[model samples]
Target chain A: MDTLNYLLQGFGVAFTPLNLALAFAGAFIGTIVGLLPGLGPINGVAILMPIAFAMGLPPESALILLAAVYMGCEYGGRISSILINVPGDAGAIMTAIDGYPMARKGLAGVALSISAWSSFVGGVVATIGLVLFAPLLANWALAFGPAEYFALMVFAIACLGGMVSDRPVKTLLAVLIGLSLACVGVDSNSGVYRFTFNDVHLADGVQFIVVVIGFFSISEILLMLEESSIGQSIIKTTGRKLFNRQEMKETNPSTLASSIGGFFIGVLPGAGATISSAIAYMVTKRVYDKDGSFGKGDIRGVSAPEAANNASATGSFVPMLCLGVPGSGTTTVMMGALALYNITPGPMLFQNQPEIVWGLIASLFVGNVVLLVLNIPLVGFFAKMLTVPNATLVPGIAAASAVGVYSVHATTFDLVLSVAFGVLGYLLRKLQFPMSSLILGFALGDMIEQNLRRALSLSNGEVGILWHSPVSLTLWIGAVAMLVGPPLLRRLRRGRAALAVG
Target chain B: MRAERVFGLVWLAVSAAMAWVALDLKAPISYEPVGPRAVPLLYAGLMAACALTLVLRPHAVAFHWPHGKVVHHIVVSAGLLLGYAFAFEWLGFPLATALLALLLGRVFGGSWRTCASGGVAMGIVLYLFFDRLLDVVLPLGLLQPLFGG
Candidate 1:
């Protein structure tokens, strides 16, 4: 009953004319950005953030708008994947596997519609999960001491190590690099400068928005330039733009299962939409498709990953809002945005700022509906966005990124820094290093250090106190298990595959 | 594979330098047992370990490098970007942005006419959008004298 009242009040807040308009505009822009190849939600949100701030939007309004964009990107990613076999974002990689095949089989409309509907289902289900589980998680987190927080952070990093990339060591390297970057500027506790290197700009620390825009938007521009495709060929829509009743019926079960799985996976720290969708697709293929038609244009193949990825996208928000820990690179950027508003997301957020929290949740419901409506009747319009030449798009993105970062402080230093990070990001991508872990580590580094110091101070420097409490112990054990589990699971799966093949 | 080794060595040197610098951190009052240096030092050590692993058992994958004209394109694009950054404040948002876009358009295979018009149009539109609508004060530079206060 209490939750119901809060939700109703949230609806009242979200339904206001200004907020509704912002949500619609955010969804529209997010969808367009997401439709562009090599530009995803992270780029969209990061590039737009300074503009949002410069416009003097209320923190809640800005968050609502950005969240809408985040959700819209999930819906928009599948268009390029299905139409041209080119994933618009990382999460849509699996979508292209089956979605493009389906498009080739002349079921482009069926693939697009089914994936859109599946994405809607996943997003809605995850939002419901967010409302129910976030509060409960926040309540539980209230009892966490510094030791527990430190342990939990360690666990989160371990989970990231286990899940984010094919090689855990590479992920760890990325995390360490991020932590090193985070060490720059003046240390708050002791007021000591660490790695400023006598530069005035270094005194304020690297701005999260600059780093995000540099790493995502700038690097993406460079990569697009490297490809240098003047025009991309896209598959034409031969069939109906809407899925048939039979196709809908066929995909329902897979969609539901993927939604559930994806949401759970999303809620876990370090696990994101990419992994969730991959796992959900694999599970769906194993259970539902006995004919082995999954990669060969099976509708369920399109449905499963689409649902899971969207669910996971929503699910990633759980940790960010509830525990103040971001689960992915994108959510980390969002958390950075919240920090700009002087709001730290965690247990106290629920008690203190119900309007912001509940309003965001309510806006998700509205945003997803807007995305579904916008995607179905107008997917063709979005597909046409593919025809946009790389020359104009790449330079345009670079100019926007430059201008956006410059607008923040009007500093030439930040522009230089952004370009530097852009080169670093390009090299990292070339080396197959997972960028998310670096961003996550950077976002969480201060908290982890703070918690570690507090815990040690309280325990009189006894390291054992870190593992003394039951909560801390549980988290430590979870971290250890996460470190050991992935390789074992991989071996087991590989052995099973070998047996099946034999 | 050789690229991985080079990357590993570079990271190793970076971590070592980080740890060395961390040793110089001076905290006046010790309110906590672990000071700011501990975390960075720890990260540096872990990163060293990872880099060592990469050096020892680097993944066997080919690193693709751009060739000939593609390399030229990448270098030119990067140069254009850097030039844009250097010229951003001095040339103002509109002119610098327009020039960069024009060059990039030509590099991206656009006809000279299309590139010229597109660059100027996009620059003006973006300037109007950011400066007028969003209230962001983009640097007008040389254009300021022409527009007048």
Candidate 2:
């Protein structure tokens, strides 16, 4: 009953005319940005965030708009994937496998509409899960002391190192680089500068927006320029835009199962939409692909990954809102935005700022519905956005990024820093370093250090306190398991395959 | 692969430098048991270890290096971006942005006509959007005399 009342109050906040309009605008802009090749949700949110701040939006409203954009991109990512066989973002990679084939088979409209519907279903279901599970998790987290928090953060980093990339060492290196970057300012506890190098601008630490925009958006522009041409032949949308009844019925089960699976996977720290979609597609293939048409324009293949990715996108919000730990790079950026507002998203958030938390949750419901209604009729138009010349798009994005960063701090120093990071980001991408882990490390570094210090202080400098509590011990064990489990499982699978071949 | 090894060596040197500096940090009357330097030192050590691993066991991976006309395009685009960053305040938002866009458009294969017109139009529209609608104070530079920013 209490939860119901809170949700009702949340609806009251979300339904305000201004909030509704902002949500619509965010979703609309997010869709267009997501439809653009190489501009994923991370870039979409990063570029708009400074604008949101400049507009002086209240923290809750700003979050609602950004979250709507996050959700909108999930729907929009399928546009290029289905039409041109190019994934608009990393999360849409699996969609292109079957979605492109369907387009080639002249079922482009069907593929797109079904994926949109599946995405809607996934988003709605995951939002329900978030509402039901986030409070419980937040309540549990209230029991955590600094030791437990330190352990938990360790587990989160370990998960990223173990799962985010094929090379754990490389991922760990990226995380360390991020931590080093995080250390480049006055120490909050001691007020002593660590790595300022006698620069006044470096005293406040590298701004998150600068790092995010530089690493993702600016470098993306450079990468786009490296390509000779952006032209791709988009397949014509010949078939019905809406899925027929039989087709819908055939994909309903896969969609539901993938949504559930993806949501759970997303709830796990460091597991993101790409992995969720991949796992969901594999599970659907093994269970339901009896005709062996899994890759050649199968409607189920199109729906499965779409549903899972969207669900996982929503699911990634759980740890971020409840535990103050972001599950993905995009969510980390969102959390960084929240930090700028001095609103720490954790157990106390529910008590201190219920409106921000609940309003964001309520708006997700509204955002998904708005996206579905907006996407079905407008997807073709969005697909046409692919024709927007890269020349105009690239320079426009560059200008927006530069101006956005400058607008916030009104400093030329930050502009130079952004370009520097852009160069670093380009190199990192070329070297196959997992940039997400680095960003996550940067986001979590201060918290981990604070918790470690507090826990040590409590224990009079005894390191054993980190492992003393049950929660801490469990988290430490989980970290070890995350590190050791993947390789063991892979070896076992490889051995089994070798035996079968022999 | 050789690039990875070189990057690892450079990273190791950076970590060593970080550790050296961390060793010099002094915290007077610390509130916590661990001082400010401990966390950074720990990160530096861990990073150094990771860098050593990469240096020792470098994997063979191919990098996508641009060639021919692509190299020229990338260089020109990068140069334009850097120039825009330095000249932003001096050239002002409108003029600098327009020039940057025009050059970038040409690098991306847009014809001169479209590049010039589109760049100017986009610069004016964005200026109005940011300056008027969003209430952001953009540096007008040379345009300040006429526009009264």
Candidate 3:
């Protein structure tokens, strides 16, 4: 009842004409930026953050605008994934696995609407979870020390090889390569330049945007070139323009479960929508793939990841608001935005600045509703991107790729690096390697290595420290079971069948 | 499978070089308890193992290089893209973008008129939206005088 009262007061602040207008504007721009090739929520927020500050809006309104953009981008990312095989950002990668196939089958509208709906549900649920559990979840998240984090990240990486592909070894190799690439820059702890090759730009290591734009956009451009010799529309736009009752019924359970699971995962510091969505897709595949329909336009496959991605985006805000620990990469930038206002978010924040805290939360609820309303109407327009002829679309993609890659650092070197990664991605793709594991490895490599090192250092270089805690121990045992269980189960089933025949 | 073997050998050489570099990478002093070297060495070691498995097994999946004109298309496209990238800072977003769009549009089977008009519109509209509206700080370069940059 008290929570409801606080929320009502929050609504009082969020419903102000200025805050509401800011919310709509942020959602509008954010969705546009998010659908652009290679740009995502981080870019959306980061780009608009300065404008919000320069306009000198009060901290609460500025925060509301930025948060709306953050949520809007999460919805926007699925548009690119459904229309093109390329993901808008790391979090949307799993959406593309099934979404693109659905688009190819002339269900682009169904994929877009379903994704938008799932994203809204996830964001709303996560915001509710925030209201109820932010403080408690933030405290619990502290229990994840370096060892536990290392174990968890390893388990997440292991999840990829075990399920994402028929060739586990090849998937594992892709991950290993991504991890190695992550090691190229100067080491954060000791400042040792590993594989810099004396290039000043390499001293900072490869940027994630550079790697992503290269690996996805470049490869996509080439693939389109090869397959588009006949220059057909990217996908047909005919068929059901929206998901029907049965389609929604089929996807509801996966979307709901993944939303909840995704929120919890997002509450963990340093884990973001990327890992949450990836895990959600894999888990949903395991639980619901009775027809082996995952990665083949399965509506469940699309909803699961989209829900998790948006839920995780909302969940990330909890740690930032409650504990002042930035939960995800996007929130880290948001933390900087807050710093511009001379605000330090901590336990005292809710008490000290109730309007700021509660208003942001209230705006999340508002922002999500706006996103759903905005996305549903825009579904047809976004889906029509499929009908964009390659003549126009191909060049458009290239220009967008260049803009996206260059805008990150405004450096030509990153642009060149993107092309290089594109070539490598093309080759690996031809060899049947799943790029998702590679991306997951690159994203998580720094986290895993840093945690491992920190945990080891805490124990004075004792390897056993990794599994010493009950949390880490349980996680280790689970990871081992995950790795060893599938093949063993297959053999057991085969043996039982043989025995029955005998 | 034969292509996989060759690719495996390439990966093996790459990992070997990675390990060699990782071995030489050193911290000035022992500031970090585990140091930076160990983690990189671990990556190198694991990569080496995967590369070896590739060399030994080289999955029986056959790999074929793209054929003839498709190969031609790929090479030209890649070359054009790299050229656009290298020339990006010099040519500026608008000019470089126009050239890239025009050429890539042609490669994708657009008529000269369609490619030219489409390319120009894309270059100009994106620049206005991203640069003027969004304040993204793109270089005007040759368009400096025209745009009063």
Candidate 4:
């Protein structure tokens, strides 16, 4: 009943005229940004965030706009995948596996409408899950001491290393670089300067926006410049209508199941939409492909990944709101946005700032509906974005990123710093290192170090204090498992395959 | 050699240098059990170890750098943007942003006429949107004498 009351109050906050307009605008702009080649949810928010912040809106309004953009991108990512066989973002890669094939089969209209519906279901279900599960998780996290937090952060990074790619060592090095970057300001506890190198800008450490925009937005511009020409022709959606009732009934159950599964995967600290959507698609394929029609334009294949990615995008927020640990790369950028307003999201956010927390949740509910209504009728319009010239867009993108970075501190030094990180990001991308883990590491660096230091101080400098509690001990075990489990499982799978062959 | 190997070598060198520099930071009045320097040193050491792994194992992946005009485009745009950043306050919004847009449009293959028009539009539009509507502080610089920013 109290949850209901709070949600109602949150609706009161979300339904305000200004918040409503921004949500609509955010969804519209976010979809355009997402469907553009090489741009994604992170860039959408990172580029727009400075403008939103400069508007001097309250923290709740700012979060509302950012979350709306995040959800809209998830919805829009499927368009490019379906039309051109090129994914708009990492999460939509699996969507293209079946989406483009469906488009080729003259069912492009059905695919777009049904996928939009699936995305809507996934987002709505995940928001409901957030309302229910986030508080319970926050309550559980309240028992965590410093040692447990430190252990949990390591487990988060290790899980990211384990799940992200085959190269854990590279991920570790990237994360360590981020951690080192995080150490470049004045020490919070001892008030001692560590890596400032006599620069006044170093006093506050590298700004979170500078690093985020530097990495995702600025580097993306450079990458887009090299890959400028879009050679693939888009499948036209001429005079095609929305999916009918029969198609919806056919996909209803699988979409719901994928939504639930994707939401849970997203709740895990390190796993994000890419993993969730891939797992959901594969699971649906294994179960439903008894007739061998899974990947060659199966509607379920398109719906499954779309639903999962959207649900996973929402589910990734639970950890950020509950524990201040970002659940995915996009949420990592959102965390930086929250930091811009001096608002650190965690348990206290729920208690002291219910308007911010519940208001954000409520606005997502509203935004999902906005995305659905806008996507179906506007699918043709958005597909046209595929043909938009890179020449005009790149300069505009660069200007937005420049103004975004420059507007914050109004300084050229930060602009140069962003360009430096952009170059670093470009190299990292070319080298095939995971950029998210580095940013994740940078995000969690201070917390882990401070927690370890605090726990040690409480224990009179005894290292034994790290695992003194059951929570910390379990986290340590989990960290080890995350690091070790993937390779061992891969080996077992290979063995099974060999045995089957024999 | 693979890009990762060469990059890893440089990273290891950087981390070692950072670790050396980290040793110099000391707190005369320390409250925490771990001194301020310990965290950076620990991170730097871990980074060094990881870099060492990359240098040793050296996995191979195919890489193709864009040739000729593409390389020129990338290098010139980078240099132009950096110049824009440094000259931002002095050259101001519309003029500086217009120049950046003009050069970027050209590098990306726009004709001179379109580039100039687009560049001017970008400069003026963004200035109006960010400065006038949002009230975010933006410098006018040379335009300051006329427009009075």
Candidate 5:
């Protein structure tokens, strides 16, 4: 009842004229940004953050805008994944398997409609989960100490290690690289410059946004050059009817199952929408075996991953709000944005800033509704965006990015830095290195360092203190399990397949 | 085989340089026994390890040099950026952007005519929005006279 009253207050704030207007505009723009190739929620949010800050909206309203971008992006990313064979982000990668096939089968309309519908349902379900569960989770996080936070950081890094490909060690190296780069500016505890190397810019530490833009966006531009074409090969898309009763019935079960699966996966540290969606697609395929049209344009295949991805996106917030730990790359960016706004997310957030928490949560429901109405009716318009000549779209994006970066700081130095990072981002991407880990590492580096220093300072530099608390110890165990378990599980599955063949 | 060793050796050298930089910090602000040098030094060690692995891995990882035309595209892109940087400080936002955009647009498959017209259009949009509407002080350079220096 108390929570409900607080939530009603949240609804009141969210529905205010200006906030509601921001929510609608944000969702609308966010969907378009998400639909654009190579940009996902993280980039979409990061790119638009300067504009929001420029507007000088209060922290809560700014958060509402940014959060809506995330929600809208989760909806928008599926379009490219389904119509083109390109996943905007890893989470959407699974959506591509069945989605592209569906598009080719001329059911692009059916696939897109199902994707939008399932995402809306998953998002709404997750919002309810947030309302009911986040407060309880926040209460649990209140018990954490500095030691626990240090453990959590380690767990976060380990979870990151688990998420990458064959090179777990490389991922570790990347994390170390990020942490080392993060250590560049003057140490907060110690005024000593660690790796500034006599540059004035080094004294202030590397900006997380600069590093992220360089590693992901710029790197992507370079890699795009290697590909034969800059845009999708235009196809005559088919399927005009949006949805019928039979189609809805076919998807509902998979939607429910995947939503549940995605929600749980999302709550886990580091694993995110991409993983959830992939797992859901696989599970649905394994269980249903519905004529095995999964990879060949089956509507259920599209529904499963889309539902899972959106649900996981919502679930990812569970840790960010409740535990002050971001569960994915986009959330890490959100956390960084919050840090810029001087708002720390944790257990006390609910008590200390109920309106920010609940209003933001309420806006999510409203954002999804706006996304559904805008996405379904206007999808054809967005799909036409794919037909934009590569020559025009690429340069336009580059110019917009350059303008956005410059607008943040009128400094030519920052543009130079953005360009430099963009080149480096291009190269790192070529090697199939996970840039998410790098961004995550860069974002979390300061937290790890600050917390470790604080905990050590409290314990008079005794390293054993990090393992003292039960919560900290358990979290460390979980992190280790996550890091080591995935590969082992894969190997076991492969072995089982061999045995079965024999 | 030797190429892998050379690549690893260069990384090792870079790691050594980074380690030296890490060692050269002034002093700690608050007393922690290890100071700020510990993490960087740790990175130095890991970088060295990775560098060693890269050099020692004998199984050939195929390295393909891109075609000359592709290389040209990359060089052109880099050159455009370099020009943008130099031009931005001297010519300011409008002219510098126009030149850079024209060059970049051409390199990325735009025609000279397209580049020129697109550059001007892009410049006006940026000028009005960034400088006029948003109160951004873009470099006026010679244009400063017209806009009140």
Candidate 6:
């Protein structure tokens, strides 16, 4: 009864004229951005975030809008995958396997429709998971102490190391770089300025928004510029409809199974949408065994990955809201946004800011609906957005970015900082380092520092205090698991190699 | 391999520098045993170790540079950003933003005609959005005489 009442309040808040309009606009723009090649959810969310923040919407409303955009992108990305055989995001790669084949068979419209519907079903189901699980997890986290939070942060950073394709050493080094960048301002606790170099702007620390825009947005722009003419040109449509009822029925079981799998995977600390989608594709192939038609214009194959991808996207938010740990790059960016609002997203959030928490949760339900509605009817229109030349797109993106940053401080210093980050972002991307981990580290740095300090203060400097409580002990174990698990897995790989060589 | 080594060496040097700096700091508090400096130093040491591994591995990983035109695009984009910074400070937000948008849009591929028209429209919408809707204070710059911002 209490939950229902709160949810009702949440809907009341979400239904306001301003919030509704923002949700619609966010969904619309998100679809267009998602349909564009090379700018996946991480870049798309980061690019639009500055503008949303500049609009100065309250945190809940901002979250609502951003969440809507994210959900919308998950839906819109499939259009390109099916039509052009180009996965708009990495998670969509599996979608491309059968999607393009279906398109080639002139069932593009049917494939797209089923993809959108499955996505909607996955989203709705995941939102149901969010409603039921987030609060319970948040309540459990309420028992955590400062030492536990410190341990959790350690676990999060370690998970980041374990998850990326690069060596754990490199990922940790990248995280340290992000942390060091975070420390380049006034010390929040001691108030002794650290690494500001006498620059007024550094006193506030590097804005994560600026870093996000620079690394993800600017770097992407640079990379896209390089590929200016390499990729396929805008695909011409043959006015073909999508999958039929029989095709949808064939895909139904795989879609349902994958969504369930995706949600479970997404709830884990390090496993997110990309892995879920990959696993879904494998599972669909293994279970259905359609004589290798799986990857070749099989509607079931396309549906499985698309459903799982979007479901995992929704599921990844669970840990962030409940445990203050992000499961993937996109949610890591969302964490950055929450930090900007001075809102910490762990157990205390549920206690201290129930309205914000529930409001965000409620808005997501609305956002997903808005996304499906916006995406389904406007799929062709968004596909047309792909036809816009990069020449026009790049500059307009830059302008919006410039205007957004200026709106924040009205200072040229911020703009300069943004551009510098852009260059840094470009370099990082070129090296194939995970950009999202840097954002995560930067976002979590202050909280981790504060918690570490608090834990030490209470324990009178005894390092043992970190392991004193059960919660802290468990979290420490988890952190150890995160750090040690990957190397162990790597050792297995090496063992296999040695056995083969022998 | 070259890129990884470059990044690794830089990381190592930076971590070493951070360690040195951490040593110079006052501990979290005088009585605090573990000390504020310990974790940071630990992190720095860990970073240095990782950096050393990168440098030691020393593989010439595939280095793919963007084409020359793309390089030009990146450089020009960066330059445009720098220009926007200075221009906004001197000319004010609305005027600077409009002019920057106009120039960048044109360079990116917009027609001169569309650039001029779209620039004004975008400028006005931004003004109303920020100034009127959000009550954010934007620089009027010389536009103080015309729009009286």
Task: Compare candidates 1 and 2 on lDDT and give the better one.
Answer: 2
Best prediction by TM-score: 2
Candidate 2 per-residue C-alpha lDDT over A171-280 given as tens digits, one digit per residue, 9 for 90 to 100: 88898888889888999888998899889999989898888888888788878876654668989899678899999999999999999999999988898988999998
Residue pairs in collision within model 2 = none
Candidate 5, clashing residue pairs? A91-A274, A190-B29, A214-A421, A214-A425, A219-A425, A219-A426
TM-score of chain A of each: 0.97, 0.98, 0.65, 0.98, 0.95, 0.94
| True-vs-predicted CA distance for residue A15, candidate 2, Å | 0.7
- lDDT digits (tens) for residues A1-502 of candidate 4: 8788889999999999999998998899888888876888988888778888888988888888989999989988899999898888888888888889988999899889999999999999999999999888888888788888888888889898888977888888888988889998988888888778899987989887788888887777777767746466999885466888888888888899999999999999989999999999999998788888777988999999999999999999999999988999889888888888888888778888889889999999999999999999988889888886776788888878888888788888898999889888988887877889989988888888989999999998999999989988898899899989998999999999999999
Off by over 4 Å in 1: A492-502
Instruction: Give the residue spans of candidate 5 off by over 4 A.
Output: A236-239, A500-502, B1-11, B26-30, B50-65, B130-142
Which digits, one per residue and each the tens of the lDDT, describe model 1 over residues B1-149?
88788999999999999999999997988777889889889989999999999999999755576678877876787778778888888899999989988998888888788888889998899999988888888898789898748
Worst 10 residues of 4 chain B by lDDT: B58-67
Report residue A161 deviation for candidate 6 (angstroms).
Answer: 1.3
Ranking by lDDT: 2, 1, 4, 3, 5, 6
In terms of TM-score, which candidate is stronger, 2 or 3? 2
* A1-502 per-residue lDDT for model 5 (tens digits): 9899988999998999989998988898788778777778887777666556655677778888888899888888888888778776667888888889878878888888889999998888878888888999888888888889989988987887887656565567667667767888888777886676777866788766666655665555555555555556744556574978899998899998898788878877678888898899999999877577778877888888888888888888889888888888888878877776778888888999999899898888888898899888888887787676545555555555555566555566766777787775555454445677777778878788788878888899899999999999898899989888989998999999999999
Better of 2 and 6 by DockQ: 2
TM-score of each: 0.97, 0.98, 0.75, 0.98, 0.93, 0.92
Candidates' C-alpha lDDT:
0.87, 0.89, 0.80, 0.87, 0.77, 0.77
Evaluation by TM-score, superior candidate among 4 and 6: 4
**Per-residue lDDT of A492 in model 5:** 99
The sequence of per-residue lDDT tens digits that candidate 1 reaches over residues A37-93 is 788888988887887887898988989999998988888888999998888877888
Model 3: per-residue lDDT, tens digit, A68-142?
988878887888788767676778999999999999988988998899999999999999999998756545645
Per-residue lDDT of model 6, residues A189-301, tens digit only: 66656666778887888777677777776667666666644346545545655556787778888899888888877887666677888999999899997587877788788
What would the per-residue lDDT of candidate 3 be over residues B10-127, giving only the tens digit for each residue? 9889878888888887788885578888887888778778777878887778667778998898889998899889877887888888898889888888889988988889889988
Candidate 1: the clashing residue pairs are: none
Error of 4 at A476 (Å): 1.3
